[model samples]
Target: MVCVPIALIVVVVLIDVLAPPHIHLGPLLVAAPAITASFAGPRLTGLVAALAVAAQALIAVLRDRDELFSANHQAQIAALVLVGASLVVFCVVRERHARELSQVRYVSETAQRVVLRPLPHRIGPLRVASLYLAAEAEAQIGGDLYAVARTGHGTRLIVGDVRGKGMTAVGDAALLLGAFRGAAHRQADLVELVTYLDGSVCWDLAEPGETDRSGETFITATVLDIPDDDDRVDMIDCGHPPPILVRGGRARVINAYQAAPPLGLGDLARPRYHVDSFGFEAGDLLLLYTDGITEARDSAGAFYPLAERIDGWTEDDPAAFLHRLRRDLLDHVGGHMGDDAAMIAIGRAPASRP
Candidate 1:
């Protein structure tokens, strides 16, 4: 690739020198540095630009020794040099921006790993897989979050979406995840764990300056506790989208009978957190996701029908199922999403005997 630009310079110089005197191809030399800027750093681009300028100067001398100092030739040389200089400047600016963007991406990925750690492929008796899609083009993680924790009796999980996007939403997500990880093990009951999370969110959002947003800011989440030896999973829904259960090639939403308010608004709603128990058999697969998945719109403004799409998908492998769903969802949204989406697939494996 680098040689192509250098060869271009050589070809242009030779052709301009060998062509008729009336024909001037010196202007084409500017393309050499322009091409170099696309794939090379500032130093290399500058070198290519200098070589192009030198080649232009050579063309002037070879084309006409007497007219070397003439206005026409001087202008041509000056134009080539100016264009090359401009291209070099452009390369410098581009490289600096590229470096800054790389740094930002590194920091974003590190922060995401800390705040939204990936779930293990296997947790106790369940095979789990998770996916997260950030709405922002340059962001790796946003308002959508999921985390899993192992307790003495069962495996606990939480999937939540913050009220908004951007840094504020990220902070809120981190807060909720931290709270869940810290208290999921200590709290004996699913309701107790959710209560602790709600209190944490309420306290954080109620801080002095945050009073204005305290009422409006809330996290919609669903917390689950799947006992290692039981076929039923206990759940507490906090105004989040219901999970989907796929059994015998049929998919259905596991709606919460008694839903509670979102985390931050628990005080206003004064809601009672109800623990809903659902059968999660060995061959059953449960999917928890954020609203972004259900709310995604295609070009025709039609929402993606997730339940219908996955109704007959009997892929028992949690990872493969989520991979197919991710591709389908992206295709449905025309390859761009307006909001962050997250999904977690938990499949109970066949029990093992001692």
Candidate 2:
């Protein structure tokens, strides 16, 4: 690719030298450095520009040796140098912006890893797989988050989405995740763990001068506890989408009978959190996701049919299942999402083990 611009310069020089002197193809030489700036750095682009200026000088000498210092030749050479120099300047600015963007991306990725650590492929007796899709064009992660923590008796997991998007939502998400990780193991049950998270969110939002919309900001989350010794999973829903249970080639939504208000709204709602138990037998797969997944719309203004699409998907491996779901969801939304989305698939492995 680097040779392409070099060869272009050589070809243009040859054509200009061989053509009638009146044609004056010297102006075409500017293309060489312009092409170089697209793919090469400032130094290389500057080098190419220098070569182009040299070629222009050669053309002038070839056209008329005695008239080398004539006004026409000097103006032509000056124009070529100016254009080439401008291209080199463009390359320098472009490279600097590229470096800055790379640094920003690195920091964003590191923060995402810390706030929403990847779920282990295997957690105790369960096979887990998770996916996060950020709607922000410049961001790789957003307000949607999921995390897993192992306790003495079971594994606790939380999948949540903050009320808004952007940095504010991300801060709220980080706060909730940190709170969950800090108290998930110590808390006696799912209800207590969720209460702690609610309190943490409330405290964070209640901070003065945080935001004008603090009153409207809240997080919808589903907290789950799956004991290693039991076939049942305990859940506490806080105004989140109900998880789907896939068992024996059938999928059904596990709606909570007594749902509570979203976190951060506990003070206003005066809600009572209740622990809901559901059968999560061996070979069962549970999917928890944010509303972004289901609310995504296509060009025709139709929302993605998540449940209908995965109704009979018999893929037992959690990773492969989520992969298929991700592809399908992206296709349904025409490869662009309007909001952040997150999904987690947890499968209970068979009891018989080595």
Best by lDDT: 1
Please name the candidate that would achieve the greatest TM-score relative to the true structure.
1
In model 2, what are the clashing residue pairs, if there are any? none
RMSD of 1: 2.9
Question: What tens digits encode model 1's per-residue C-alpha lDDT throughout 162-248?
Answer: 987667888999999999999999998988888889999989977887647868888999999999998999999999999999998
Candidate lDDT scores, in order, read: 0.89, 0.87
lDDT for 86 in candidate 1 is 86
lDDT of 1: 0.89
- For candidate 1, the TM-score is 0.86
Candidate 2 clash total?
A: 0
